[model samples]
Target: MTAKIEIYTWSNCPFCIRAKQLLRKKKVKFTEYGIDGDEMVRAIMAERANGRRSVPQIFINDVHIGGCDDIHNLEDQGQLDKLLFAHSGV
Candidate 1:
């Protein structure tokens, strides 16, 4: 089974771009929420992100994975792929 990946972002945010790039490099499929100038959507994303109002909030299989740096850190630690391919029991 594949992991369910999601990312909240603004159209022009550099971090968001970088995060997406990393995911693309990994060849992981993801859902992107581009909340550019959409405060309502941003607020929803913030709520989902534990009150973090930052762009590029990421989630894997409904688990919050934080922003770009956080994902990169996970990659550096050799854990991102594990999470990306983990199978959850339904």
Candidate 2:
């Protein structure tokens, strides 16, 4: 089974671009929620991100994976791929 990836971002956020680039390089399909100037949507994203109001909040198979730097750190540690491919058959 393929992993379900989601990212919350603003249209012009640099970190958001970088994060999406990394995912594209890895060839992983992802859903993006671009909440630019939308306070209500941002609030929802923050709620999902454990109160983090930062753009580029990510989720892998419904698991919160944090922001761009966090995801890059996971990739550097050789852990992101494992998380990406883990299948619980849910």
Candidate 3:
């Protein structure tokens, strides 16, 4: 009944690593899609990210939560935990 978290990342991207680190530190399970240099996969991620062709696009319960700084910003504002602990009606 937990929220389903997903992230699109590039293997060597620092932002991606930082984002994943935060998620791991929180001890939450998330699905990570490592796009690397695959443009087709990147295109799919971009579409899900509202045309944002950046690495480390995040989603919580299928809701777009933006990139690394965005997730960190949510955590800073005391909102990330709310999303992480939510029950998805899926």
Candidate 4:
């Protein structure tokens, strides 16, 4: 089974665009929640992200993967693929 991928973003946010770009480049399918000026959605994202109120908050198999830089770091460390392909127990 494929891992479930989710990302919270804001329209026009550069970091959000960058994060989505990376996921697209990898041909990964993800559910994106665009929270442009929407406090409720942003609040939910923050909660899932352990109170991190940042754009481009990501999740793989319901596990918080953090923001744009964090995802890129995982890719740079050669660990992104592992998480991408991991099966979701949920």
Q: Which residue pairs clash within candidate 2? A: none
| CA lDDT of every candidate | 0.93, 0.92, 0.92, 0.92
Residue lDDT tens for model 4, 1-90: 567999999889999999999999988899999999899999999989999998999999999989999999999999998899766432
What ranges in model 3 sit over 4 Å off? 88-90
Model 1, TM vs. native: 0.93
CA lDDT for candidate 3: 0.92
Model 2 lDDT, residue 19, Cα = 99
| Cα displacement (Å) at residue 36, model 1 | 0.5
lDDT of 2 at 16: 99
- Tens-place lDDT digits, model 3, residues 18-70: 99999999888999998988899999999999999998999998889999999
- Tens digits of lDDT, candidate 2, 22-55: 9999888899999999999899999999999998
- Deviating ranges (above 4 Å) for candidate 4: 88-90
TM per candidate comes to 0.93, 0.93, 0.93, 0.93
- Runs of candidate 1 with Cα error greater than 4 angstroms are 88-90
